[model samples]
Target: MHAGGIGAPTIARTLNEEGIPNPTSYAKLTGYSWHNRPSSSLWSAGCIYSILHNETYLGTLCQGRQLTPEGQFHSKKNIPKDQWVRTVGHHPAIIDDELLRRELKARKEAGAHNLHEQKKNFPPGIFGKEVRCASCGKILTKGKTLRKTGCERTLFCPTRKKSPSHCKGAFISEKHLESAILHELKNLADRYSDDRVQIGICQDAQSADLIQEKNRLKTAVELIEKEITAYEQRSRDLYLKRATDGMSIDDFNSALSRIRNDVDKLRLKSKRASSELLHLNESIAAESIRMETVLKAADFNHLDKTKVSMLIESVYVHKRDPKSGTQAIDITWKF
Candidate 1:
């Protein structure tokens, strides 16, 4: 095959016709564990073109050029070039400088043409990293589903498409997802308009339960303090008795030792109760602040990037039950 070809598809077709194995196929045959689904093992124009444009094949290579979000397993995206780590002579070169230049020029032209074509029908993936599968916990990807009427944009679990056993979460229509969110937001807005109603709806029951626990601990600490005071008084009385010769030295010391041990126990109990109360109060305060943030932003009718960031933390999309034809979704608010 010619190194400089007509285009990606033509080159791919030629490679396929010549019985060359695709990347995934070759990897499998050589005992490499590639993560992609078996069905995607076929050679495609996009995959072939991506390989041809990769600069790693030219010996010198840059690594850590992309990063995933901290604490998240998936959702990888490219970082700025300045942030990338560069290395020279990382591997043996497969293509020379002159060949690399020609390939880069052709790739640039092809990319521009493809971008123009894509802009005509592509829908913006507004919820890019926010939507996730509940079962497999992977980020949902956007795609277009063609129908008799036109193309409908949807989000699906990428893992499920590759293998059903991995994730069987149903595809969600972007239109439906947006509509549901809007309706829920509108409902929140209506409820939030009234202070009493807002409190009733947004108030977390866990906060109330924590307050009860806090009160119990406070009561326990007070009781322990009283017991400690009583113990100290008994020790003082014993000292007075010993000083006046009303008690023997051995008896006074023994009684004081018992009192001291009892007081120590009370003090330890008081400290534990105080610590628990403090922790409970901190939790309640944090939860209250989060709820307040949600209540403050309740007037939203439509969601934009700013609104989404402010109001929502994440959205979990569960698999749809075939019998019910309903998909379960959980929306965690930012608060």
Candidate 2:
């Protein structure tokens, strides 16, 4: 009604006049729980806004929205957007899709009455913050390029619009950028998995070397601990021999002093070795997870938000080549 001609107050008054139940009143009559008092069941602008934004009426049902740990329903848990399951066409639609779209558009215009409006003609692409200009170090915003063939998706450096002299008009086609990124990702995955690759460039080889180093350090630590134990036993034996008069007191004291010094040295070596081993192990684990993530990303056929966020840190777009008519893109991996 707000999108049509009626205002919020008029809509509320019409609902009350027609004896139609508001949300809380309807929910209460339908056996649903409403914590509010019965006196506050009248419709208002806030209620209208909530109804307009709710996805349930658009033939979609969203589940797993609440993270109810320990079965506490009242506690508000901030669940990530990705974790929510949305099932489209799971229920009957109360409104047509076109009407819903118009209402949404209207609401957006109303909300942005005093704010900067977003560009609406952007084609489908997944390069959010990942794409940037190499010359100016600013994000490349998406726009369309009109060519003799047709319209092609393009990205431009925002700084070029303000200070053209600062940047040499950094721009590139989305198709070329995506192809470069996908090629680089696939190359990385292949390099890690190929046994013929050099150890310096191979992720698997680095991981293996880290594991071997960690194991060697662990073994060294164990040897040092055994030596410390042996020294402690020898000191005990020296004390027993002194009591039995098998050796002189001065000789026993000298042996005990040497054994104690050896034990101290071995303890220090063991501490250092253990610390190094712990750090090496952590590095190995992190590298393994990173490799797994990259390999999983290589399975994607096209770019998406998830894949871009997981695989790419940033893409530097160099100036286009005049002869080859292709821009050089340097992709920095997240790992």
Report every candidate's CA lDDT. 0.73, 0.76
Candidate 1 lDDT (Cα, whole model)? 0.73
TM-score list, all predictions: 0.60, 0.56
Clashing pairs in 2: none
Per-residue accuracy of model 2 over 143-232 as CA lDDT, tens digit each: 778789877888987656444444676888888788888787788778666764343333466666887898899899988888888888
Span of ten consecutive residues with least summed lDDT in model 2: 114-123
Deviation of model 2 at 183, angstroms? 0.6
The window of 10 residues in a row where model 1 has the poorest summed lDDT is 195-204
Writing each residue's lDDT as its tens digit, candidate 1 over 1-335 gives 33545665666655665667887788888999657564554455677667766667677688898788998767888988778787867989876857767867876898799788778767565686888999888888887788787878889876665445445665897877777777666665564455443443334355557878888999999988998888888888788888887788788788888888888888988999999999988887776665555555655555667777766778898888889988788888766
